[model samples]
Target: MIVETPQLILRPVGTNDVSALVELDSDPAVMRYVSGGAPTPRAVIEDWVVPRAVAELSSRRGGGMWVALDRSNGAFVGWFSLRAPRHGTQPELELTYRLRRAAWGRGLATEGSQTLMRVAFDAPDTGRVFASTMAVNSASRRVMEKSGMRLTALHLGDNAETDGYERGEVEYELRRSDWESARFVWAVRGSTSELTA
Candidate 1:
């Protein structure tokens, strides 16, 4: 495990995980909200997920987004990441997550997101983290807010695949200043893990 939380262990993505990631990404139920209901092709997963992830890890000095495993049973749950925004502005990273539909409503998204936020801010180049999702993606929106990101903007996004979803995307942001406030709140509650950056 690269990092351990109260209930999760974040492990580096290895070559052995490609099949599982392909399976996860291919779950129609899991991919519904992401790709307007179509499953991601295995070739796309290889062409996209692997090299991009290796690149992120290499550049971040080993602080790449991670594959989350269950601490209790060692189950593959999902992946969470805090990526330096490719768009150059405001020192912001992007927070992202994808979990099995079965994992929904279990607070796993919130847990993993908060952990990734810490990991992100712990790094040298990251100053803020943002999350974006379809405005209709309320569950994802809630997790973003729950992880300390605040609603910043909502704009029209032309997504050719999602039929009528073209109205736009909503974005939320969490700066290092507010992250400190969040950690303070968690500390008061007796959290065992330390918040970094």
Candidate 2:
């Protein structure tokens, strides 16, 4: 599947993205919150990450991973995913995004996340969309809030060795009912503006 926003084009990840994924994970800054600045080995991306993404895409169970690209120049910006919850049932997908350092502070993460949330809720079966990040990762928290998800829980840390793990994790969620209400308000306001115009 393919999706587009004004600033990005998101498509299913493939073998071609292995190198790009490696480069993205290689940046200590990019992986700071994820792996405590340890670069993901290229072999992992090739053997495990890419294959899993491919399988997710093929299964079409919940939304899979999508590689985000710059609309103007087609640069590899990052990847976004909405997948079935590991510990939860269907219709409750988890949202996630990982972008290159160059993409930070550009609002691209929020843009992509908002788009995916819409995609999830557009499906009649989807009941909720949620995400989690290290509590210390203010940037990611802001992205989740900007995407209309509210903080639902705070998970205590269990692994001191993990970077940012000492600070714990925050979970955010948007329910289908809330999303529908917000969309309705936007639709009404849009029509009002058009009528006034």
Return the TM-score for each candidate structure.
0.88, 0.92
* Per-model lDDT: 0.78, 0.86
Candidate 2 clashes between residue pairs 3 or more apart in a chain or in different chains: none
Predicted structure 2: lDDT: 0.86
On the 0 to 100 scale, the lDDT of residue 142 in model 2 is 96
For candidate 1, lDDT tens digit of each residue in 36-111? 8787788776787776776778885324668888888999988887666566656667888899776788888888
**Which runs of model 2 end up more than 4 angstroms from their true locations?**
191-197
In terms of TM-score, the best-performing candidate is 2
Instruction: For model 2, state the Cα shift of residue 74 in Å.
Output: 0.5
- TM-score, predicted candidate 1 vs. hidden true structure: 0.88
Tens-place lDDT digits, model 2, residues 1-197: 79888789999999999999999999989988888888999999999878877886676555788999999999999999887765776578889899999889888998899888877776678899999999999999999998889999999988777777988999999999998887777787774211111
